[model samples]
Target chain A: MMPLWVGPVARYMATGLVTTLALAVVSIAVSVVLGTLLGALLVLPSRAVRLAVRCYVEIWRGLPIIVTLFFIFFVLPVIGLRFDTFVAAAIGLCLWGSANVAEVVRGAVQSVPRGQADAAAALGFPWRQRMRYVVFPQAVRRAVPPLVGLVVNLTQQTSLATVIGVLDLLQASQRSIERLTLSSGATHAVPILGAVLVVYFVICLPLTSLSRRLERSLQRA
Target chain B: MTAVDFEPGFVFSHLGPLGQGLARTLAISAVGTAGALAVGGLLGAASALRIPVVRQVIGAYVEVFRNTPLLVQIFFLYFALPEAGVKLSAFTVGWLSLVLWGGAYNAENFRAGFEAVDPKYVEACRALGFSELASFRRVVLPLGTRTALPSVTNTLISVFKNSSFMIAIGYPELTDTAVDIVSVTFRAFEVFIAIGVVYLGLVWIFSLGAGLIERRFAIPGGH
Candidate 1:
């Protein structure tokens, strides 16, 4: 049987879908920049910088996403660090994605041939210019496929943001259930949840397939 | 509302009650991960057999699990399924949700592991007249397990961390405990910090164990 929650199903799905996309895009943008920098510094000549970055990534990655969400959402306000739900969620996700992305970036960057760095050095090119022209370009190319996969994962992680009342997709579904149950004493879980799943599939399928294809194409090349 | 006072013993005292929740979290995570391994392994094995029917079914399972968020899965199972004569205890829904969700992802890992095993080993085993089971156990497994170690560990870490989704379904895990403490004591910072610290400790311990496993099955970096 179709859900009675069908009344608000479209509205809930549309709201949740847009919120998910916003979270994914903002989180990805923040993390990619921070991750790239963190990764580069981790490979820097200075031991302390590498060690510090390593610790930061390790600390963030080791904690559960929910714990991070709670820490940012609840704890921040205690110390006078207030944020709206969106900002809090975005920061939590950015921190988590950055840790993983940094590792991915470092792995890709290190995979680039040492000879390229040697050639750059022989030409008296400064390190920044060489990394920009010679190294980062190749690393970035190799990193794109995996980074795409990371973004897909991050999209799913945004569901955690609802804990702090962001009213994202999951929350929207829950609200529909609550309202419907209260009004009619009947819940339309099937259609409501089914609709939510369909939305996610439509959003995620392309990215997932693209990454897989890129992995194959990259391997062949 | 006046922010509640940060009395010292009250927060610490709640730890006694909170231990039950923490234990539940650990148990749920362990059960969920074990269920994922079994379900994922079967699906992976079936899909890898190249049977069209099994492949199609497993593909759909993977799609449903992979595309949606775990929180939604838990909520659907916990809150919605009851109306359909598929009632579950909160704990049951929590564990089953993770099993269903994590199984899909882990199946992909297993399939990848199955694919990367050397063909020559299987050919040699076949030439020697070993049973398929024997060959899979002796040859394909050793190599595939090594290749799969890093990804498996990665999934394990995820399964452990994702355990916190139980909060949505009201399973009363660490995250929920932190919230409760914050509500009661108004020491949001301390409570949240404590929650993060505990999760970090647990995950660190898990990583240490995984690192040891990875080291045991060290392979060439080419893959």
Candidate 2:
């Protein structure tokens, strides 16, 4: 039979994966909506609004995600807005993800041919109509591959939530190893750690390859 | 919500250790970036040359590092290695992990740079009878490095930011110093903000330096 720790450890890791997935899903959703809006705002006619958005992106992008996590986890509590550790992690990831996604979104939108915009203008299309009919479709097509890549990054980053006590897969493995060591004599740490590594490797490796393939095919088109 | 009281003097008072911490952060970043560039340069060159085993090895390295969380990599180094009879200090493990991780990303960036070199240029070099190594050194490396500059700068900044993760493994870096101060004074806001300012300063300075290098090496009409 397999080692006794296998079943429980698998269950524990599964739970951790759930948390990781939930965190990524919620954060990605929030980031996509907010990022797309902020990206649109980056090209706004109003100088002050564009300036404010630029600073926001620069600050978040410049700071480490861990520091952002720490700030939200620790500082928000001081101001009477306490969040669960997972919630804090999600919010932190959201901030960093949105900043980066905003940049990607802006780049994608800007890369759409200016001629298209000029043609739309010459045809008397308003800004909203032009964005809806002429611009967003192409930008979204251009954005999908990079956006998927960003999600993969966010998935990897959810592991950082372990530092803030989120009991992620890494933390689960750490806890299992400690527990096994205490309960049974002379437990090896490698197998357990290797299992956790394999789990991450399995999830992430394919996504990255897929992203590269998409990028290549997009270039071809 | 009542506004948290504005506090400036706390961080100012602890500037000495924090300054030391900032220095350590910079040291790690500089050393890590250098190591990454060295490893990545070799791997990228090998890849561009289509070396048999090296390409596969680099592919594995890039995928593994890119896919996994840096925190787990750090932990495996810090925790697992000791069990395997390789005792490494938290600082050494932290530094090594950053170098390894940065190298993988750097390799991809460099490979992209290498691929960006036009085929016609290589053909022209061949027509001049320059040896492969000679032509690569004379033409490819400079062009690749220039093409790779922006991405490499971004990677360097990320490696520096990632040095903060070392705080989890007990490195006496800037974020750790800030955590220490916050614990003692219960002033999380001021402490983190102070450290953030230093981080911002470091990033800005490095960006300025990168911009200078970019200008110095910029080829006319080169992207």
Clashes of each: 0, 0
lDDT of 1 at B200: 87
Best by lDDT: 2
Please provide, for model 1 over A48-107, each residue's C-alpha lDDT reduced to its tens digit, 9 standing for 90 to 100.
999999999998888888788877887677767779999999999999999989999999
Per-residue lDDT tens digits of candidate 2, residues B1-223?
7878968887789999998888888888888888888888888888888889879988889888888888888888887777788888977887799899999999999989988898788889989998888888889888988999888888888899999999888899888888888878889988988888878877888889989988988888864
Cα lDDT tens digits, model 2, A1-221, are 99777899889878887887888789889999999899999977799998999999988888999999988888988999868999999999988999999999889989999999999999999999998899989899899889988988888888889888998888888888788889886455777777777888898888888888888888899
Best by DockQ: 2
Error of 1 at B50 (Å): 2.1
Task: Look at candidate 1 and tell me the lDDT of residue A41.
Answer: 89
- What alpha-carbon RMSD in Å does predicted model 2 have with respect to the real structure? 1.6
Query: DockQ, in order, for the candidates?
Result: 0.59, 0.73
lDDT of 1 by residue, B89-116 (tens): 8888877887888789888888788778
